[model samples]
Target: MIGGSGHVGARAARALRRLHPDLPIAIAGRDARRAAAVAAEVGGPTTATTADVGRGDLGLERGASFSAVVTLVKDEASNAVKRAQADGVPHIAFSDFVSEIGPLVAHHVARPTRAPILLLGHTLGGAATLAALHLAQDLRSVDAIAIGCVVDADDRGGPASQADFERNEQIGQAALVLQDGRWTWARGDAATRRFADAEGVEQVGHALPLMDVVSLAAATDALSIRVDMAARDASTRGAGHATDLVVEVSGRLDDGTAARLRYDIVDADSYARLSAYGAAIATERLLGLEGGPPVGPGLYHPESLIDPARAVARLEELGARVRRTRS
Candidate 1:
């Protein structure tokens, strides 16, 4: 793991340890002390290493090997990606945005590797998209999809996540969405939507150009697709106020009648934990630990590599509650 010291990365390490007890783990980050602490907490053949993501070799000694490279940080320079490619190991990146993924895609196209590269930058590490796709399977046609994620106000993420938020604000990049089968850069009111949250409270969500919009569009013929997020105070809401992912899909049924479906994935714990579960699950899929074939070379979305039903089951096992709000 590249950012194994951060909150999400550390949680991913723990989740991986729980899922695969004997897997050798390397907690790598710029902060050697913090990495060591995390590794010690994870226990069982885990090592902490100082890694410089900016370096070509990831600042590791020559001949170092790993089964896969999972990064929870934003790799703006794509250094980690290139290194993974050179080593021919599966790579899973969690913090890249759709606007900044062009160079990485281009690099892979120029020289594809035998190991798979999974882009899991969706809301909560592709959790929302995977659930939405699974729910849409019961419909005959999918015309529109809207995903909303609620983050607790007090749940400020790690340094890397906060930095990414600050960087996006500084850059002022418009949110990406698909409308009427056309890609659009939404802004202001156009980028905002009002919907009921998991607690049935009215909330306004703002678009952020997450990877879910693109992935959903490719998977189904959804004429309109967008993902928005809202942050609120969880303390005031009593219990069941942790982060939640709301997915709504609308289209026609097999009988040609109008239909809509909505589901809520409520996590009683922090969003970081839910996201970590997603990363750990993806790591297992890449390594073929679930008795399935390992992912082959080429870039892919989480929807392509993961089975939504199985992912939902795994999330529930990890303390996420999935409830159908509409049908």
Candidate 2:
């Protein structure tokens, strides 16, 4: 994995080791010491490599080969993706996935790879969305999905994650949401809306743009998709020492009914940890495919390639309490 020596990437590397003990894993980063440290943590003879994206060979030996490379590097995603395409290697990106990457995805489709490129922009999206998908496993006709995540303002993520978050803020944080059967741009992730959290305690959420709006809609064929993220309320701030986040996904069924899912997790180390788990899960699933990779040479989100049930089941195993309700 590229950029696999940081807080998130390292954790992901460790997770990968736990899941695939025999798998040869490598951790790449600018700091060779740090990469070596993370490799040591994995307790395997993992390779510690430098990652200088610009210095040709992407900071690795030429003619290097792998089943797939999972990129946790943010902002530099396009470059890494380009490198993967050039090497004809399958790539899975965990961050820096935005709508603007459309062109890169299209390019991959035209050029093709030995295996499909998976962009997990909506990695595990929201608890509700996953739970809803598990409930709708029959592939029922659904028209809308209300998915949002609650994050604590004080709960800052890793450096790369913070940078990615800041970039979205630079864009005015307006999200394209499905409203009344049409696309409407909404402003900001701080517009508060009242909702009960996982514990049935009232909480607030602000609409925020995450990749769920794009990938979820496309993957599920949902005509409408709404996304938001909640920042922690001061009331619960100083009271707890654990990191926490609330994720919800609600869907409009064909019968005009609504189904919602919720998960309140306390003790999330960082978004990086969750992302690492997600990457590991996807990797495990991909490696487990009977004949070959699920989809052929093209860019796709996890929802499109992974079975929802399998995906969420793994998430729970990794530490997420998912609950579902329909009305």
Candidate 3:
């Protein structure tokens, strides 16, 4: 893993160990000490690699091979992904908070790969996509969809993530929501939305066209789709930050009936821990360790590639509560 030293990386390494006991793992990062620390925590025959993913070449030794490389870093992923493609290694990137995966995804679209390179994120894109897809199996004509999510205020997503959100929010009057088969700029422009979290607290949310706006739109071919997210209220996060994610999908049924599916997600672990679990589960799926052949080489987000049911199961296995309601 490229970012095995970070919080998410360490947690993910531990999860990966639980999932794959015999799989040799190397915690790779720029700092040997940090990498070694995480490797020791993960136990097993794990080793440390003083690899600088920012360098793109990953500072690998000649002839070194790996089953997969899961990165917790984003800023360097653009180059690192290119390098992984060159190295003929499968890659699974943790969510890019900076939203820089567009160009990378675009490039892959232009020149598809035979090696699966997945962009699996927990927020914005990945979570909502999974929720929508899971409900999509029984729905027909997904004409419209709206999802509202809430994270712990403490999770503010860090400075880089905030900067990115502000930058994107400023570029348009509101987030880029899909409406009437076209992109529209608005924030919660559809309706008043409320989310009943695991704590039995009802919270209001705003519409923000996060990455899921695009990925979900494409995945469901829905003409109208939007995602709204906010930090869980301060009162809830005062003690510690646990993520409270909610999603809703709506459309017409094959029998011409209206249908909607609402989802709730609660994870006791911190956001990074939840993300670590997600990344590890996705990595296992991609590696085909749990069975089934790989999806073959291609640039894909977790939603486009992974089976939604399986994905949900993995998240719950990692101590997350994911429930859905359909009507």
Candidate 4:
């Protein structure tokens, strides 16, 4: 993993160690000492390596033998992705890019070569989407799918994450899902929804367009996919800084049957920790399975490649709940 040293990266490294103790995991970061510290914490056969994501050459030998490479570094963003493509490495990108950033980074990574690239975006990106797919297994066609999230405001986030959010705010609002097969670019407050979870139901969410929607739209035949986010336990007006998430997805199955899926994640740590778990889950998926079709080069959601049932099982093991309602 290229960004194995940071908060989410480190957590992912630790999770990998627990899941695959014999795997040779390496944590990379700009700071050598910090990377070493994280490797130490993860223990097992894991080792720490120093690599600058900002620099083109990550110092890896050409033709290095490795099954997959994960880019968790936040600073270099697209640069690391390009370099990985140059090295002809199958890569898993960290979940940092939002739809407002445009397609520059994703496009660049996909433009280079046929190397498989998976861009991890949002905790709901892969696992949650997969859960939706699993729920839709009994159906034939689906008109739309809406996934909702309630994240704790107080969750710790890294500098890169903070920067990404700031950039989105500066860039204005993003696309919101509309009825039929339409999307509208609306202001942040223009879209809002009510969310209820283990904590309770509250009106929350903004017009934040997530890359997961983009990836899912590309991956599945679902005509329209929407994601709304809110805080679980508090009202939108007084939601203090706490790390929690409540997501609900509604759509029609292939047979024109209506269906809905709900998922909630309550993390005790800050935003960074929750994000870390998301990244870690992706890494585990990449390393754990085999014989799957190589996910092509481009930005991808977790659901695109991983089995929804498997993803949900892992999340539950990590303490996230998946809920479904029968109609």
Q: In candidate 2, what are the lDDT values of residues 59-88, reduced to their tens digit?
A: 776666666667776625366776767766
- Give the poorly placed runs of model 4, Cα more than 4 Å off: 59-67, 75-77, 96-114, 139-143, 176-179, 219-224, 231-245, 252-259, 265-268, 271-274, 287-300
Worst 10 residues of 1 by lDDT: 232-241
* Candidate 3 stretches greater than 4 Å from native: 97-99, 106-111, 121-125, 157-174, 187-200, 206-209, 237-241
User: Weakest 10 consecutive residues, lDDT, candidate 4?
Assistant: 232-241
Q: Best candidate per TM-score, number?
A: 1
What C-alpha lDDT, on a 0 to 100 scale, does residue 218 get in candidate 4?
A: 61
User: How much does each candidate deviate from the true structure in C-alpha RMSD?
Assistant: 1.3, 3.4, 3.4, 4.1
Q: Write the per-residue lDDT of candidate 1 for residues 140-173, one digit (tens) a residue.
A: 9999999998888878788788898777777785
Model 4 per-residue lDDT tens digits across residues 1-327: 877887678777776676678878888877889989999889998877777766666665454555567876554446666665665656776645555334435554457454566767654435556656666565565556666555655433676666766776676646456446666665645566555543565546664566666656665567766667654433342333345454445566566767664555555554455566566667655554432644555545577567766766776676654445554
Would you give me the overall lDDT of model 3? 0.70
- Per-candidate TM-scores read 0.96, 0.83, 0.84, 0.80
The runs of at least 3 residues in candidate 2 whose Cα sits more than 4 Å from the true structure, single-residue gaps closed, are: 54-56, 75-77, 113-115, 123-129, 138-140, 188-192, 221-223, 233-267, 289-295
For each predicted model, how many residue pairs clash, with residues at least 3 apart or on different chains? 0, 2, 2, 23
Report lDDT (Cα) of residue 162, candidate 4. 68
The 10-residue segment with the lowest total lDDT in model 3: 232-241
TM-score of 3: 0.84
